[model samples]
Target: MRGLRKVVTVVDEVLRDVGRPVPVPVRRVAVAAVVRNPWAGRGFVTDLQPEVEALAPELARLLTGRLIETLGGVERIEAFGKAAVVGLDGEIEHGGALIHTPYFGNVLRELTEGTSIIVFSDDRLPAGEPLTVPLWHKTAAATRSHYQTVQIRVPDAPRPDELVVIAGAASGPRPHARIGDRRTDPVVRLADLEKLENAR
Candidate 1:
């Protein structure tokens, strides 16, 4: 929690869709922590591993805990993702260093009992700019119904020498998802297409 500035959490619930009541509301939550960037103002310092080791795991645990609590529990988390935004004075890689490594992502994965790799996004932006965190099914990456996103922003954060790290979760798939998953969708191989062309 070193150099921590503030924590922000947002919850979005979809209770109705197309003017119809949904049986189970879809809930998406995002937790973000604005922290001072350790590398900020240090021009081109080579190795980030030491600070990454020192910070990522604890940050991950804190954010993930907040996300799970806001969502009710780990069982409520069916989809998950992460994101980070670095302030203007910081490198985009500074944000990437915190959230991209296993030290950060694996904590969420382990706590949620998720099998699929957690999806993510990272960028450099000014304070108060909104960022969208992309999410997918926690256990099945190809589960199209669970593809979702949560947008988060802090009005005053990442002040030129800081990073906003985020974790996102969804309680369920999109309300009334009708599209089938990738596993059941028909596959079109390039070889088959070539054979068809030759026959034509």
Candidate 2:
């Protein structure tokens, strides 16, 4: 199927005036597309690989370019993520088809040189709804400041026969990150039930 009916982009900049020793600022952006759902309302299709292979790279290229443009350049980006929202007529896997493969991440990793995995969100939604795309530091998952989300809302998209696919980027981590990464830091770990409750 020839995919990509439309593309949408959103960017947000946040600033903290007094949350830390010095003021903090951040930039986050997302690029999403509304495309014809190749499998929607169709009977069981055993092989979805061809469709996936055909679409993943193109979507990755388009989104990554937009992300670079939004952030001024690829060098300015520190975190990355992706997401998709399928139309009512489509299956959840339709959304997954677009964002789950390394074919997609390969583009982001090559361009951004992001070592850590890309976070994601995929769900079925109607037109004019919000899709929250999660973000994380490229190589430093333990860095608290890089965890973020890009929320995109298309006024009239992902119509019954469509899917909303997305990619995202961030200039830095959270403004005031007191917590550490659960993946690397020992402090951010499992705690005894008694100690956890006592602190609360």
Q: Number of clashes in every candidate structure?
A: 0, 4
Model 1, position 153: C-alpha lDDT score: 89
Candidate 1 structure quality by residue, lDDT tens digits, 27-118: 99999999999998889979999999999998999999998899999999999999999999999889989988889989889988898999
Residue-level lDDT tens digits of model 2 in 1-200: 27678888898888754654425578899998778988877767778888888888888888898999989998899999989888988888887877888788777778887888788888998898998889988888767777778899998998998998899899987767768567665553356666888899
lDDT of 2: 0.83
Show where candidate 1 strays beyond 4 Å: 189-200
What's model 1's overall lDDT?
0.92
Q: List TM-scores for all candidates, in order.
A: 0.93, 0.88
Question: Which of the numbered candidates is closest to the native, going by highest lDDT?
Answer: 1
Give the worst 10-residue stretch by lDDT in candidate 1: 179-188
lDDT of each: 0.92, 0.83
Clashing pairs in 2: 116-138, 145-173, 145-174, 146-173
